[model samples]
Target: MPPGTPFTVVYELDDECALELANKTVHGVCHLGWVPAADGDYELRMAVLVKPNGFLGRLYMAGIKPFRYGLVYPAMTRQWESRWRNRNRSGGARPR
Candidate 1:
């Protein structure tokens, strides 16, 4: 996505809610480790929980090659790192 592009989604805080993220562009589900930062924020459903080296990462590498040719692993790493830094700065909490 382009810079400053806003993403909108509905976050459900129910305990039954799966610890997973479904990327519409990649068309795959990623098993996100149980991180309950937000009780009800749509961005939770879109966070990059699984790295590109993981199972879904390989699939995205193979499938996304045809469209603009981009990989998810690098993106996932960048995303996770940035989020981690932000979280640390906000409240100085370590990743679990």
Candidate 2:
């Protein structure tokens, strides 16, 4: 997604499914526990965080444990989605 665009956390708990995509940006951290296929190993369940720029995304996905992924992910997403529809309105009727 674009800078300052947040996302609301939609936690997935499915078995043997991989590659849950990020909203707009091309890549995202893989929740390792989310099994890629049947009989797959337990990897990791990511909290899906986003950086202001792509650079941070790379640093994060590259296993930068120093940063706190648990805290930042869901918060920003909520903010982004709250503002997203308003920001991209195509002349729709305003809510009463």
Candidate 3:
């Protein structure tokens, strides 16, 4: 992403990464993690943490709750799964 994008990389490691975003209404972190599975594969996990700036921020979060749960999260999961599948097909090594 460009320098001015809302999200900024906080840290990245072999199994996890975090990005932060702050705006007038809210501040948030998006974390993506990978864990070894019992089946000898990796599982992807994601979490979002947010702090509301004030009333507007609280309202904004509430307003987007449905879309976030119903659309955004599912879409993101699909994209990640696709990338993982493609990587395996191409014999790409997992990020470390």
Candidate 4:
């Protein structure tokens, strides 16, 4: 997450971070976690929880579902992956 994004960081820890967003249409929280793998590596996991404000809100969420899945999420994943790859080169700088 960047400075100008709509989401506000609720909390962050070594292995997890939670970001929240609220608007007329919905309130949502996005959680990112790093899970330990059996092979002694870590995998990134994401979960989003949303609450619709009303009928219109529900409709809005439904409408954006396709875009979110087809475009937004994939792009975000790529960006994160790139960041992760460059982290060591950058002296392990934390993601902002």
Best by TM-score: 4
Instruction: Report residue 31 deviation for candidate 4 (angstroms).
Output: 0.5
Candidate 3 root-mean-square deviation in Å: 3.2
Candidates in descending lDDT order: 4, 3, 1, 2
Q: Which residue pairs collide in model 1, if any?
A: none
Which ten contiguous residues of candidate 2 have the minimum total lDDT?
10-19
In model 4, where do residues sit more than 4 Å from their true spots? 92-96
lDDT of 3 by residue, 10-82 (tens): 9966567788989999999988777777898777788989999999999999999999999987887667656
Tens digit of per-residue lDDT, candidate 2, span 5-86: 3432334333221233464323444332332335553322334434433765565555644444454545544543344335
Candidate no. 3 TM-score = 0.75
Per-residue C-alpha lDDT of model 1 across residues 9-95, encoded as one tens digit per residue: 233232212233345333333332334456542232233333355676677666766542255545654574466446557776443
Task: Let me know the TM-score candidate 4 reaches against the reference structure.
Answer: 0.78
- Clash count for candidate 4 is 0
Cα lDDT of model 4 by residue, 1-96, tens digit: 666889999997656788899999999998887777688766667788999999999999999999988998778767755666466586864432
**Model 3 lDDT, residue 37, Cα:** 79
Clashes of each: 0, 11, 0, 0
**Model 3 off-target regions past 4 Å?**
1-5, 80-96
Q: Alpha carbon lDDT of residue 10, candidate 4? A: 98
